[model samples]
Target: MIIPAIDLIKGEVVRLHQGKFNLKRKYLYEPLFYIQKCLKEGAKKIHIVDLDGAKNPNKKQINLLKEISKYQIPSIQIGGGIRSQKDIDLIFDLIPNAQIILGSSIIKDFKNVQKWFNLYNPHSIILALDIKFNKNYEKIIFINGWQNKSNMIFEDIIEKFLNIGLKYVLCTDISRDGTFLGPNINLYTEIVKKYPEIFFQASGGISTLQDILNLKNSGVKNIIIGRAFLEKKFTIKEANLCWQKE
Candidate 1:
């Protein structure tokens, strides 16, 4: 599946190159308008990130979500600032039917994640792994929209989460996220190979259809495209049409 991203900051649709918080660009279309364009273009799922909340817990992006949720677009999956049960509760209160994604929160407190997993249906939860491939080639999951580094290794973290009964994970290579360069195919391949049972949604650095093809070849079942899809490097219609070709 292809999930188009809607990054929010003070109610604007922004894109960050390489997942860097400082490198953001505002889109011409409004948040809801952009989401509608993507949905009409053939996207079955939408990905939304609360940028302000990701950077500062004091901020929220509920307005953008409320606007998008007004439409009966396909499934909407959201992440960012989901640290506490209150935050989760607030999200459910606003967009109750939307899928909830945990970013740095789940990594910081696995117990809370476990509790949510036990309490809610697995389909409603997604663990977002914002990762960085270090100079030594060690893969580690980054947090706070790739600003902070986590001690957890990618594979080990996946193993731990999978063992805890969490089935869905959105893995984004911080080094390539929002770059529109290309995805970390080898890293995705390795992870998918190790945990084939986990429902992995690959994100970051998808620039071309070949990148999508390579992801499919690597065993990835779903992917998130932010910069590329919005920039017209490719269109959602093209992406959906190409899925069958793969």
Candidate 2:
């Protein structure tokens, strides 16, 4: 599935390079316009991240999210600064069909996150692990909007959650995010092979139809596209063709 991603900053659509706020590029259209375009082009699911909320949990763009919830067509997956039960309740209240994405909170409060898995359908909660490689080529998880690094290893954390009913994981290569360099194919391929039960959503650096095809060929079922779609690198329809082709 080619999931069109829209990162929001105070209700405007924007893309941040390598997860850096200062290096973001704002688009001309608002969130709804892009959502409409993606739907028109046959996107079944849409990924939305609240940058404002990611930076400060209290600063979530509630009005914008409310506007998005009005369109009850696409399966919406929303993330960023969604740390507690209150946040989860608010999102479900506004967009009942939305899949809540949990990031930093999962790492900081692993035990509490387990309660969420028991409370909500496992499929409705996506665990987002943003990663960066170390000098020795170790995949380390970065949290807090990619500004801070944690001591957690990518595979180890996933291993811990798998037994606890983690169904979906959105892993982003922070180094490749918004860079348009290319995806971390080797990493995703290895992870998919290691854990075939989990539905993995590959994000970051997907700039071309070939990238989508490569990810699909690598056994990655879901791909999150941000800058590529916003910059017109390829249309959702074209990417879907590449993904759906046998």
Writing each residue's lDDT as its tens digit, candidate 1 over 74-96 gives 67888888888887777777767
Q: Could you tell me how far off, in angstroms, the CA of residue 6 lies in candidate 2 after the best superposition?
A: 0.6
lDDT of 2: 0.91
> What TM-score does each of the candidates earn?
0.95, 0.98
What shift in Å separates residue 114 of candidate 2 from its native position after superposition? 0.8
Off by over 4 Å in 1: none
Using lDDT, give the best candidate's number.
Answer: 2
For residue 86, give model 2's deviation from the true position in Å.
1.0
How many residue pairs clash (N, CA or C atoms closer than 3 angstroms) in each of the candidate models, in the order given?
A: 0, 0
User: Which residue segments of model 2 deviate by more than 4 Å?
Assistant: none
Best by TM-score: 2
CA lDDT of each prediction against the hidden true structure: 0.82, 0.91
lDDT by residue (tens digit), candidate 2, 127-241: 9989999998888999888888999998888988898788899999999999999999998999999999989999999888889888988897799999999999999999888
Superposition TM-score, candidate 2 onto the true structure: 0.98
